[model samples]
Target: MPYQVLARKWRPQTLQDMVGQEPIRRILSNALEQHRIHHAYLFTGTRGVGKTTLARILAKCLNCETGITATPCGTCSTCQAIDAGKFLDLFEIDAASRTKVEDTRELLENVPYPPVQGRYKIYLIDEVHMLSNHSFNALLKTLEEPPQHVKFLLATTEPKRLPITILSRCLQFHLKPIPLELISDHLHYICKQEQVTADKTALNYLSKAANGSLRDAMSLLDQAIAYGQGSIKSDDIHAMLGTIAQQNLFPLMKALAAQDSNQVFHAIHLLAEHTPDFSNVLEELISLFHQIAVSQVITYQQKTDQQITELAALFKPEDVQLYYQIALLGRRDLAYTPSPQQGFEMTMLRMLALQPKQMVVQVETPTLTVAESPSWQEILPKLDLSGMAYALAANCTLEKIEDHKVILQLSANHQPMLNTKLKDRLRESLSNYFKQAMQLDIIITAAELYTPAKKQEQEQVERLTDATKAATQHPKIKQLIEMYDATIEVSLL
Candidate 1:
């Protein structure tokens, strides 16, 4: 016998043999058992997700000599013929080629006739959306009201092109893409059955490269087997798919998490030897960061990798969020740069540069005399406040500080940040700062005030304005602008 491809040889011969389409299988099986099969059925989904395969199994169930059943006896002549694609009653039409109205009309011409061998004359149209509008018009009448012994099974990757008139006459079921874990498990089973020595890592790479298509995964598996000389290895799969190995991804992530710039560059330098696709590298980082974030919130049944668990502990949740966002935006702009490696390096450096700097509030020593009191700005750094509590205190000015009570005035604009929990935290921090218990009162008003935060902002603006003025007055800048007929836009560091 000639060599048969794995996809066709392992094609599902029965509904029970199908994978990753539980709902469709259950519905079709119930329909067969209850004799509630629709005259016209439409299956919609992406390619290689078992739309036509399930349709063939349904045909076998309908025409088996034993009876109409969810489980057709494969030993029967009728079931065997349908499986072999030689059943006289089964008409497998490729709508892509025969899209003319005349072809459709000719096919429907026989719809009124009875079955020659099987119980029903089944018309299975693959890629039915390719049929012309006129062809659809010609077949609408027969499709809607076919004879009792005829069944129409239509499959298409794109269902939107089909007219609503035809769609309404058929029962449509949309198949979902197979999940990565399920695909990997299935591939592992297939390798075992074929007596092939395959590593788990190899199967994982194949499943991910398949992108939710079993047929594509099977075809890639066949190529991997031939390329590896009847073996499946992670290195061979990575070389075949132009994907970076998962182990290599961990070093990059670890360097980023540690904020070690030297290690990050070193990792990239080592990665250059493989000529890896930087875009895929960024994607892998994004995916790993996502997994780490999920691990922090939920406990998975399968234990996460030791490296991932360690790296997850090294960064804060907010830091992970910041890195993930920057990585995604970097990927979007990567193509515009001169080279992908340069873009990827810049992205990683940006993540480290913008790493959320932890706030370290340092209080100056009290240098004032007993009569000279400290201002709210001077007292803010003394208080052990952080996060929202620190923000609330920074935005407010002290109106009065008494023996047992204190009054703070918050600007009307910042009133939205004030809440009961934040107010309590502010009061606690103030009591600790003063080394005494205190009651607190807050009042909101639109009044001119010099909050510590406002003072800091004013100081920053003045410094920037001074720098820009100095740059604008530089003789070199003036000479360059005149010589090149160019404009100088002074930007402050």
Candidate 2:
């Protein structure tokens, strides 16, 4: 006969044959057994997650000669006809193509009629969201109240675009994305059945490349098998996908973790030859970091001989989190740049920039000795924002008493629960060696916590108003006003 792809050839023939959708299958099975049949149903989920497949299977379950059942015998004539796409009663529609109101009106007009030839008539509309508004309106009444023999199975990846009126009428069943582990196992099954020798690692890579889509994975595996001839390997799969070799990323990650600037730059340069998508490289690092993180959490007994053992030893969990943050920022900056390569380089630099500052600044300043006073003069001007924040917590404000510790007013608001979680995190995150501790004393002042309108900037603007008013009347200003017939929209000092 004709050449058959693995996805179609190994398609699930029964509920038992289906993979990675236990919840949906279990629900449908129970519904069938209990005879809790709904007139019309909507199946929603991402592409290649068995939405269409389930619709087809459900069609067989409804019309099989064995009677209405979830586990329809695939050997039966009705089941075979449905499986081979030759069933007259099971009318499969790609709403994406037949989305006009006239088409919907014409087709749905038959919903009132009983099944023709088969026990039940099944209408499977794939990409149901693509139906036009008018078409959906035409379908609404029929779908809500179809004849006893008619079953409408609507499927769409984008369910949000579907109107509530249509959605409300149908019994919705969401077909979820298959898991990665399940996809990998499915690929292995396909390979063995195809009589192809393939490395398990290659299948794992294909599973990931599929991104939770079984149809995509099978299509990819078909191409990989053809490319590998009699045997399939990870290297061949990687090349076929235009994916960068894992080692190309491994050394780069190693250098970044080591804070080896030279080696990191060299690795970035080498990536140019492969023409690797820089964003993909960052994503690879994230995945690697995730692996290392889970590895660190593994107990002694759980440390079986695995490939990630070395990675667990090489990086700390905290370092993994840090690198992930840097890589995330780099990826976010990709769109704003003029050149993708420069964006790529900037990402590298950003990842490297997390290395702790090495420079030490030494400054000498004269000290001032102040006489003892009943109350200290608060020197708020020289205090940095962080320092000011600390002083605000203490009852008394700190004075710049020649860089020595000054007092700040403290209140009950500084108590743990009263203080916001954000402030506590900021307090805990100080340089480990030696950061100034803010001290508190009770000072009666009318000052409130800094507000935007009360910020030093706005305060300065308020002060400059008088000066600006004075300058507005200058003789030179008058002369300029007359010369250009100009009024000062803004007067600059």
Candidate 3:
């Protein structure tokens, strides 16, 4: 009669009711039907992915009054008692608390005794990894060879902590995290059954916020129901979860795709009122870019808004990849910045600034005279390059320039930067610099000539060497060694 949370209330009583774990359910079901019961079984997965729930369902199957069966007759007293958590033979231990070797020994002392009320004495230990090394040692012998009437169901989120000796004895069933769509559908079904009016999009946010855990999704759903006063909508869910509105992100994406600084700032200002977590905002932006990238390759029914489709069309595939990589790096470096907002703004600025430079579209070639020919190092800094194009140029040494073809040697290690798109951009930049359409041929040979990057490194090393020599010959250094016989640990300034 007491109030039960949706997670507990909707707990799968049989394997058939479980969602998004078909493989695990099928294996357990086959084991039950074939009576291929193992003395010890281990269920390993993250929290709320039905590790304990599956263990309970397996216990019911073992003790069901009709017989040991895959599909337990839920009407029977044994199943009913187990469901109510009052079954005598089913001992559910929270190993986190009872982790001492003595507790393990005491618990195993009863393993020899026959089941009091059921066919099998089920020892369901939750968080089995929390047991001490000595306790695991204590459990090893009995766990390997328990009594005929005994069964061990070990569940742990951190299975790696469990000793290999104990792990080897058990039939390990590693449950996977439920898929996003499945969790969303499950939440929608629960909302309908509970008479809770909810938008599909609202359920989607909850499902994603759950991060592939059904119990987590259900908990968030309960909070959302109360937050929305029983009617769940996307806007309210976003507000409740402190999540960036997906719609607000579209304008920023549009601005980024168009390389419009003003619109990017305006869009970010609109979100400023919400005081959004900029890291999460970047994450949402990254997600949108990822979706757009996926759309380029695989053709699927568009569940996205017209804005997303239009934005996807606006940006090329290479741009999406570049923006995604920049956003990820920005998010990674965000914590070290002065503030989250500044870090986020700089990231957006970077995307816009790099866009035009990285664009591979044809443009007017710059005028150049043969009399003004300069070294590759000087030529590199003079060229309008940034991002991968700039990086590719900096790492290359000019081999030869004849008529319309320019040959360069890049280090073999940096060959990953030698893609068709980068090559095309480099060729275009060279054509503009040379005032003629040029073909850039790159060879993956060691750069013997002074590259821009190599020249810069050489300059830095020379400056450091000069500074160290200057300091070593200083008057103060001579006085210190002569006066006190002090040996100084000198380093470059």
Q: Candidate 2 or 3, higher lDDT?
A: 3
Positional deviation of 220 in candidate 1, in angstroms? 1.3
Candidate 3: tens digits of C-alpha lDDT, residues 1-493: 9878889889988999998889888888898999999999999998899999999999999999988899999989999999999999999999999999999999988888999999999999999999998899889989867888999999999999999999999999998888999999999999999999999988998999899899999999989988999899998887887778778888888887777899999998998778877888888888988888887766777576676677789898978887888898889989999989999999999888766242222222223222322468778877888999999899898888888999988998888888998889899999999998999889888545456777667756665555545545667666545533445443332
lDDT per residue as tens, model 2, 1-493 = 9989888887887787888889889999999988898988888888888888888888988888888899998888888889889998988999999989999988887777777679888889989999999998888878766777888899999989999999898889887778999999988888888799999988888999899899999899889988999689987877777666566677777777788889988888887677766667767766777777877886766744365667567776766776666667667877888866788777678667644332222222223333323332323322232453444432233333323233333333433322444344333332111255432323334555332213434545654564445445666666545533445543323
By the TM-score metric, which is better: model 2 or model 3?
3
On residues 346-408, what C-alpha lDDT tens digit does candidate 1 reach at each position?
999988787766422222232322232248878899889999889888899999988889899
TM-score of each: 0.71, 0.70, 0.71
Ranking of all predicted structures according to TM-score, beginning with the best and ending with the worst:
3, 1, 2
Worst 10 residues of 2 by lDDT: 357-366
Model 3 global lDDT (CA atoms, 0 to 1): 0.86
lDDT of 2: 0.72
Q: lDDT score of model 1?
A: 0.86
Measured over all alpha carbons after superposition, the RMSD of each candidate to the real structure, in angstroms, is: 13.1, 15.0, 16.0
Counting clashing residue pairs in each candidate, in order, gives 0, 12, 0
Residue 389 in model 2: lDDT:
49
